[model samples]
Target chain A: MEKRYDIVEIKENVLADNDRVAGKIREELRRSNTCFINLMASPGAGKTSLLIKTIEALKDKYSIGVMEADADGDVDAKTISALGVRTLQIHTGGLCHMDADMTFRGLKELGFEDLDLIFLENVGNLVCPAEFDVGAALQVMILSVPEGDDKPLKYPLMFKVSDCMIVNKIDAEAVFDFDYEACVERARALNPEIRPFRLSALKGENVDEWIRYLDGFIREWRK
Target chain B: MHEMGIVLHIAKTLNETAEEEKITKIGSVTLQVGEVSGIITDLFVDCWNYFKVRNEILKDSELKLETLPAVTFCGDCEKTYPTVKYGRECPYCGSYETWLLTGNECIIKEIEAETL
Candidate 1:
């Protein structure tokens, strides 16, 4: 006896649906004249600290909204809310990353109608968050000095995809043996157009330059 | 790490497709994962194994992954080369004007199931 089984040809990209949703969210944000930035990094990369500093610098000039996504807990969201910005905490319920649909839902909950800029503090995993677009106009990743310079080689995809690479914890450069020049070179090799800024989010070292760049970026984005 | 989330999504999609097609049991799922898709096949299969036990539709389903090679296309030379080997630079013409044509995909290509 011969057995038979049906082979269904799906040919569907699992991320394609998420990409479509992300594209729609991008168009929606564009129509609303809002600049969306997706901030990604490994845990303890000073993402929240950098966001606080950014909000402190830009809050007076532009209406800001924050979406803090984590596997669980609202620590970052609480911290951002204390800065007086409209902040929404999205608990990913154990998911390591936020996809486009998740981001769309977060935007709906945050309500970016009257806001000029929105920042999505993506779940702190360098690998997963970089894979999802999340409708961000710019994708930025922070690499602390402790993470070492070989990160660009180990995690090439994250560096290759990011529009901007922020090297946080520059103040700790004296303590850690981080090769700043080599890191920048490796990142540039992966993505020539990648704009890298070395700053210490905690000590406020060179943060003004980051704020300046962002000021111009937001202004140009809103134009 | 996010492979668990991806597994959940795949299981959900398979369940829905099975329901639509009147499939009672899923024997196996052939997933075509690109070399540059950033998904660790070992971790992905492990996550699938863990998730399948909880999902009735995928309880006994076997997860098979097929690796698709990463390929890049050079605009200047109009040539394609292995992305993992040559990266952004075209191997043939040594041109930097190259874009990835394939090998960033996490797709479900085929599904084998039993009818009700």
Candidate 2:
């Protein structure tokens, strides 16, 4: 039997479609003057705590909104709401990461207008969240002191994709033997353009530096 | 479930392509997965089989996998080496100032299809 089969030469990246949607969302966010920050971290890595600290520091300066993407929990939403910040919790339905479409839906529900900053505290997993481009203006990932300083070596992609790396739980550095210099060295080796910050969200130490940097970042992004 | 998520994305891309090209049945899908792309091929294949049965256009389709070896470039020595073997530190120069040149890609190279 003679049959014809066409070869479709589609040399496209798997995330190309996702990246296009992400680009659309980024442009739309820029038009609305909203800085969308995608915050990623492993479980118990102080993502929420850092967000709380940053929010508390910059809440008065900026009209902030938060989109919390947990697997299935509203506890963080409730906590953020207690600060009088508008927040929405997205249940990932057991998905490990948030794609561009999921981020779009969350941003739509949260409403980006009249808000200077919106943070998508992405599903707590370093590996998957770093893989998807979720249309964030700034991608921030945290490596807690207790998690050790060698994380950047193990999770190279997460470190590479992130625009900023927050070495959270600096207060626990003494107890955990986290070498800040070595950690930054590892991260810089992978991504020299990455901006690193050291902060202890729980003790409110060095959170000011992170806040000031973010404040400038949001303003600069709008400009 | 990372592979499962990737499978969903692949399914979405396939459906969009099918619509654009008017492909009635997809004969096969070929993917170029990099060594450092972190996709477990066995798990990915398992997920593809599990999901394709639910998709009308993809039910009869088989996935063809290809490997893209990871390579890294050393800034100090200006030499390239296998990423999977040497990792971040450049084996040639023993320098920490190294960057990946390839092997982190997940791409759809081509598809064999039949049109109505």
Candidate 3:
């Protein structure tokens, strides 16, 4: 007797399924007149700081929400919730990124009925977060000044996929030897339409420009 | 890394698939990974090896990965080029109207199982 094995041909795309869910979420957000922004960055890239500033600037005008995702802990969530807006912390348990399904569940928990803007503070990792769409109208990538300028070349996909790149911690430019122009040039080489913003979330430097851009974007999206 | 999460999902999917198909043991799993899928193949296999021992159905399973080249379609020039090289801009016509055609996919292509 010969041992036989059965080969099962299951041609299923894992990310495509996630994209489908993300597309559905996008449609739902559009119907509700909500602008969802997926924020990505390396650890300690001032993502929370930027969110705090953005929330402070826009919360009065728009109904805002924040979905803080981390491998573990709700410290960021606590910070966002102190502002008195809807906030939810999603512990990925150990995952480095949040997919569309996870974001959809987070949206369900936060209740998107009255929210005009939702910022998904994705887990602090550049590579993984860039891979998942998470149903955001805009994908924003933050690069801190201390992270060096060659990051765009190293992590091309992250820069390529991002709609806007925020060069945070510009206040530390005097201390760190970061080539701002070179970084912007590299990002432009990868993605020609990438809008690069040089700002410092901690010093409140150039944040108003970002706020203005977001205001325009949200207004256009709502229209 | 997120590869651990992906491996866990793959294992869960395999387990569910095996259960529905009445498979007692999975011999191997063939995954088609794209060049730009953001998944490191070596790390993914290592994660699978680490995870397989915990699951009886996948205890002795072998993991195989095939690389799918990344390609981008240029809408302006209507040409396809390797994404890893040309990126968002079309190399042929220097147009920014380009989108990814393939590669950025983590797909399960085949699964081999044994019936008890």
Candidate 4:
């Protein structure tokens, strides 16, 4: 008699389903000529501030939309909508990260059709958001100066996976005892191809440079 | 905290696999978790134990998790070593030009089921 183990070898990729759904979302966005960005950061890293400033700067040139994904509340949504841009709030029901399906649903709620850009503000988390792809053309991470320089070493995946790193709160660099150069160096050591920007969204210092860069990308995406 | 969601995902995948394999009951599930995946094994296990109780098909199923060590490769030295023991800096070449090779997976490697 042969001994049979109940163990069945099933080698399905864990992220395969997510990637497939993300592919479909990407295809839809491409067809509609809507460039999507997935913004991630720790809580109070200035992601929403950046979005608000970016929208105010480019409101004349582009039709922009914003989607805020968090576990609860629609405060961010209200702020964005007050700027006269279409916005949607998605409460993930205590989920830490925003996946592709949630983003697609948020897009539907926002009536994403022929929009120039869609900004999906992921939940304020460093680790979970890095693991989930929300079908974004670019993954942008904001790192505040007050978050400490050692953040890059501790949370490598977020920096490694992000396409751009926005070093926010530049105006508070002096008061926060933050080393901006070291942060960029460490982040570059992790991902050399990552685009780094230094700006203070509140004071509007070097923000237009970011707006110009993003506007250029949007223009190229449209063409 | 988010391990509950992952457990749900595991349950969904297991149910689909059980249906396809024509298995009546699931006995066990073995997972290979990477050290660098940022997942908490204890939390997942706890969530799995509680979450599975609600589903009739997976009420008695067991979850076994095996942790994988982090391995990385250095481009300059052309050497592979443990990423956790040594930082991003290569031990042999002292170069930071290293890429992660393993230890980032959260995969269900095997599922044990019985067919009546």
* Highest-scoring model, TM-score: 2
By DockQ, highest first, what's the ranking? 2, 1, 3, 4
Clashing pairs in 3: none
Docking class of 4: medium
Q: Which stretches of candidate 1 lie over 4 Å from their true place?
A: A1-4, B15-25, B70-103, B114-116
What is the lDDT ranking, best to worst?
Answer: 2, 3, 1, 4
lDDT of 2 by residue, B54-107 (tens): 999889888999999999998899999999998778887789788889998999
Q: Which ten residues in a row have the lowest lDDT in candidate 3 chain A?
A: A10-19
- Candidate 3 DockQ vs. native: 0.57
Query: What tens-digit string does per-residue lDDT give for candidate 4 at A120-195?
Result: 9999998888887779998899999889877888898899999999999988888787887888898988889889
Per-model TM-score, in order, reads 0.87, 0.95, 0.85, 0.93
Candidate 2 regions with alpha-carbon error over 4 angstroms: A1-4
Residue A211 Cα positional deviation in candidate 4, in Å, after optimal superposition: 0.3
Residue A33 in candidate 2, Cα distance off native in Å: 0.7
Summarize candidate 1's per-residue lDDT along A94-115 as a digit string, tens digits. Answer: 8989999899999999998788
Query: Which 10-residue window of candidate 4 chain B scores lowest in summed lDDT?
Result: B1-10
After superposing candidate 4 on the true structure, give the runs of residues whose Cα lies further than 4 Å from its correct spot. A1-6
Model 3, B12-108: lDDT tens digits are 6787788889999888889999998878878887888899999999998888889999999998999999999987889999998788889988899
Clashing pairs in 1: none
Candidate 4 TM-score, C-alpha based: 0.93
Classified by CAPRI criteria, candidate 2 counts as medium
Q: lDDT per residue, candidate 3, A6-45, as tens digits?
A: 9998788756567788999999999999899999999999
